[model samples]
Target: MDTQIVRCRECPLQGCDTFRPLSEDKLEYLESFKQGEAVFRKGEMIMSQGGKAPHLHTVLSGMLIRYRSLDDGRRQIVNFMFPGDLLGLQGAFDDDLSHSVEALIDARLCVFPRNDFHRLMGAHPRLGYDLVWLAAKEETALEGHLVSVGQRTARERVTYLAVWLLDRALATGVADDSNRLELPITQAQIADMLGLSLVHTNRTLKSLREEGLVDWAPGNLSVPDMDKACKFAQYTQIDSKRPFI
Candidate 1:
């Protein structure tokens, strides 16, 4: 982790249509707000549940997961992060994070000191609003996930997860031109996210594959027609264009 502040204006994410643009004044302050860059290898823990994160992070590149693990050793993956996604800001209002983040692949982050969340909001209200927007967006997606786990069938659950990630990946240009995700995740991880067992997850995935809805493997997923998959999963996609700090 380097402690040198990064120039937010020059951030590559700023050039992507996936993220909202910052105003001249706001961009300048964001540059100062950044404390530096943090790089993580695949499977590295970015932050842990019940631990303090010294800095808030925005995904500069690559993929990661936010998950919560229970005492019995079961874990549920709550969310995934792509370029421009914010991380660790939930620590602002509380002492420790409710969940943990881990890199799914080699990744880079533009980090801002955790304490400055207040300064950004109190001094620069617009930037603060952006933070809330980011939080609310994640909340909305989690709500959908909750509904799926609570009521959807095993097949529907798998379909929903694939659709959810595929939609977001395409929106972020993280997926290839072929509309496929070289997802750096395993079937066991998928089971965790969908609240299913590994055996059940595998069965459902085979069914989907046979049905021609998706082609999924340990580190890859392909959705040929997202609309059809979404319809099958009864998934409502959040707008592809999203705000990020």
Candidate 2:
């Protein structure tokens, strides 16, 4: 496979309003600091829990999942990372990765050596601000996920997740004006995310389909009516601007 060269100024996601573009000098400096790009196949581990995090990554394409495993071998997915999401920042601060990141599909990443990443942030205050903003956004997503898993019913949990993914896809410019979106995850992964068993997850999805709230195929999930799906999930839609890092 040929490696696709990633240039900061020519990034396809630069059009995302949430991501502020770096100045010419900063962009050039970042380009100099970049080591290269790495590609991973679906189901491959991008970064492992407890492993050395030598570099920070910017997701250039494809989806990823951040997760942690319990001593008993149960895994809880913490979040789904789309394009423009930053990875290994936590390790940049703590010197090791606390959770693992896996590619949900074939993925590509722009890599920056950890030391150079710190230098870039320090020398460019605007970039530093962007990093902080990204971190806060991630924190907010975690809080929402916690509430969904802890307090929501199985059906509601699934509904909210579907809506959330669709919204995210739209915000990131991956999907068009259509309500349909492709979700490549399995029911088992959804069960892991919602803290439910595989059987229960299947049943809840069936209920949603029966109610005309959603349509789920093997690798695609679509909401026929976004408003109705939100109502079924008891979700109040929030239109927050997302940053592209």
Candidate 3:
């Protein structure tokens, strides 16, 4: 744990643009309630499935993958969590983690003990509303993922995932101005997320590359035109104002 005080108002990653700004009093209260910071190396588990969820984590930097494994050890990635995302809220309500969260890159997080967070929310209705708003956004994303896996073709699935990820990266300032986003997950992991075989996922990616829709090399992915990309994926943009927490 890093003990250096991290003031909420001074946080760079979860900016006011990405999340609703807290009032000065609310900020001070959160700063005091925050336990500290914790760092996770790439591939390290931040929260394990079925484990006690004692805290909620605010991503200060880097990326994380949320996944669940079956009885036979097959894993499906539920979502990619970026900077400004909140983690462990489900656990805060349920007492146990339903999925595991692992660092996709070297990451830092602000840790808030769940009990204190609950108390703060109880006292601050406005803050509590923000939390619900965050949960609803997460639910919308998950619903989209469910639709992708259940009805889309392999090529469309791949394209949809790519475009979706790029949009998030851009919104969160993870991507450079050139529209290039870092994708550190392996093809095998992607296959799991898309519900396809490894070979099928590779072929789909190759087709996407040949069509000039996307470029993937090493650890980076670039989308040349988001409009075209979304068209190929049959993506319909959801219109809603997102609240930042």
Measured by lDDT, the strongest candidate is 1
Measured against the true structure, the TM-scores of the candidates, in listed sequence, are: 0.95, 0.92, 0.93
Q: Model 2 compared with the native: what TM-score?
A: 0.92
Instruction: Indicate the residue-level lDDT of 68 in model 1.
Output: 98
Error of 1 at 4 (Å): 7.9
lDDT of 1 by residue, 1-245 (tens): 77654578787767777777778888878767777899899999999998988888898888999999998988899988888789887777667887899999888898888776777888798778777888888888889899889999999888888988888877776876586899878999988998899999989989999998877977889977788899999988756567677
Give the clashing pairs for model 3.
Answer: 19-244
TM-score for candidate 1: 0.95
lDDT of 2 by residue, 167-186 (tens): 77777766665988776889
The digit string of per-residue lDDT tens for model 3 on 1-245 reads: 98775678887743635455667888787777789999999999999999988888888888899999998999999999987788989888767787999999998998988867668787777877887887788888888889899999988888898888888877777776587887787889889888999999888889889998877666888888888989988776534444544
Regions of model 3 farther than 4 Å from truth? 14-16, 236-241
* Candidate 3 to native Cα RMSD, angstroms: 1.8
| Top-scoring candidate (TM-score) | 1
lDDT of each: 0.84, 0.82, 0.82
* lDDT for 152 (candidate 2): 90
